[model samples]
Target: MIDALTVALGVTALLLAAWCGFAAYRDQPTKDWHFIGMAVVALLAVVQLVIGVVRLAGGDDPQQGVAIFVAYLIGSALAVPIAAFMSLTERTRWGSATVSAAAVVLAVLEVRLYDIWGGVGG
Candidate 1:
């Protein structure tokens, strides 16, 4: 995995979390701008997923094992979209909260991805 990309994703997710969290705090549902932000984060996650797959295809195995690593990649890629969908259904402050929670999850997944790839602490 690319360390810089991992860090970038993590930072972006945290930013999204804070943004949506504030919306929830203000008793608002996720708006168009929030979805756009989610889209950006999701795009980054998909890019990361593709990179991870390409590396694996090139015989670069993650230290933690391929199955788990791929699972994390897929989960991370889906997290935001799934939350966004759920947010749509709820259409309340909780919807924003859901997105906020998913962003936090994505951030956590970024750290775990780094570890799975044998980053310093792994």
Candidate 2:
């Protein structure tokens, strides 16, 4: 697993979380800008997913079990999109809250992904 890429994803997720949280605190609904942030995070997640799959296919086994690792990869990749869709259902501060929650969740998942990869330099 690439530690740098993992760290990048985590940091981006956290930033997005902070943005959404600020919007929510201001009682603003989710905006196009927020969706753009989600798209960026989702793109990074997709890249990470592809890299993980290729690495695994090339016989680089994760220290953790394959099922768990792959599960994290897929879940991380889908999280932002799922949250965005849910946000679309509400047009209030709650929508921003949903996105903020999703971003935080993605960050947590990234950390777990790192652990599942057996940590940096593993």
User: In model 2, where do residues sit more than 4 Å from their true spots?
Assistant: none
Candidate 1 has its poorest 10 consecutive residues by lDDT at: 113-122
TM-scores, in order shown? 0.95, 0.96
| Model 2, global lDDT | 0.92
What does candidate 2's lDDT look like per residue over 11-34, in tens digits?
Answer: 999999999999999999999999
Best by lDDT: 1
RMSD per model, one decimal: 1.9, 1.1
Please report, as a residue range, the 10-residue window in candidate 2 with the lowest summed lDDT. 113-122
In model 2, residue pairs whose N, Cα or C atoms come closer than 3 Å (at least 3 residues apart or on different chains), thus clashing, are none
User: Which candidate's TM-score is highest?
Assistant: 2
* Superposed model 1: Cα runs more than 4 Å off: 120-122
